[model samples]
Target: MTFNLETERLILRDLRMSDLEGMFELDSDPEVHKYLGNKPVKTKEESQKIIEAVIDQYEKYGIGRWALINKKTGEFMGWSGLKLNTKMNGITNFYDVGYRLIKRFWGQGYATESGKKAVDYGFKVLKLPELYGITEMEHQASHHALLKIGLKYIEDFYFEEEKIKLRWYKIENK
Candidate 1:
């Protein structure tokens, strides 16, 4: 499950065990999870399991979120890519484009940079008919990033279990 996609200043690659520390750092920050149910992972083991699940996703689905590394420093910044979502937000099966970075890496356009590449890979490489994105209603940054990645606003849906309103966006391959 090894693959790599390079942006101008970052490298998007499969999540591996070597990324446990960086993944922990990125996921443990409360600020980074503010819009994500405010649940920052509490242990490195949790991060390890998360990475392992992503690796399994690669084996099962052939694609998943990839680690985002700083090309110049080779530091793991975070993860950005596509994930196969099943029965999410009332959708049976779909590919969702997403990204996340360490708080320090925020505001640096890394998400958008890698996100655009993910969208390109989805359309051109995977030959997906369309791509989808979902963000908390108030996650302005995520909303903007998805739009910038070329997805158009589709609609907003209420996630009953989470009791949250989520905005959905989509882009079709033409």
Candidate 2:
């Protein structure tokens, strides 16, 4: 069964193939995709594959990225949730809280609300020992959200793939 998580103004749920267009729009914004990836998704197929992969991840790992929806209008805003990032150094293979909201929805506290809920879900439902999040050094917005969710900055480094300096934030369940 697909996981459906809700908050006051947002709904986080399994991504559907139909979400590709909206997802592409979100990824296309250079400001939105800046820290997450160096580029926007070039094709609808790429978005579809990514959504399908997220679906598989949810089924296999019991937790994965959830598509963010606007509760008021039922519009696809973006995605936010937890997943295992096996490539990271300190907290590889653990739930990593993340979010990508559209430009229109920026600065509404949706990211923080969703992130807080995600952290609680990791600890209470998934029973994970920790929750972590990563943001580029220049991303003050995300850094603030991390702090709001009780995550402390743990490291600063550059990833070879993105070639960008990043700051890692983490919080242990304990």
The per-prediction CA RMSD against the true structure, in angstroms, equals 0.9, 1.3
What digit string (tens of lDDT, one per residue) describes model 2 on residues 45-82?
88888888998897887778898998999999988989
lDDT of 1 by residue, 23-136 (tens): 999999999988888899999999999999999999999999999999999999999999998877778889999999999998888888999999999999899999999999
Candidate 2 — worst ten consecutive residues by lDDT sum?
Answer: 86-95
Best by TM-score: 1
How many residue pairs clash in all the candidates, one count each? 0, 0
Clashing pairs in model 1, backbone N/Cα/C closer than 3 A: none
In model 1, where do residues sit more than 4 Å from their true spots?
Answer: none
Question: What is candidate 1's local distance difference test score?
Answer: 0.92
Error of 2 at 173 (Å): 1.2
Error of 1 at 56 (Å): 0.4
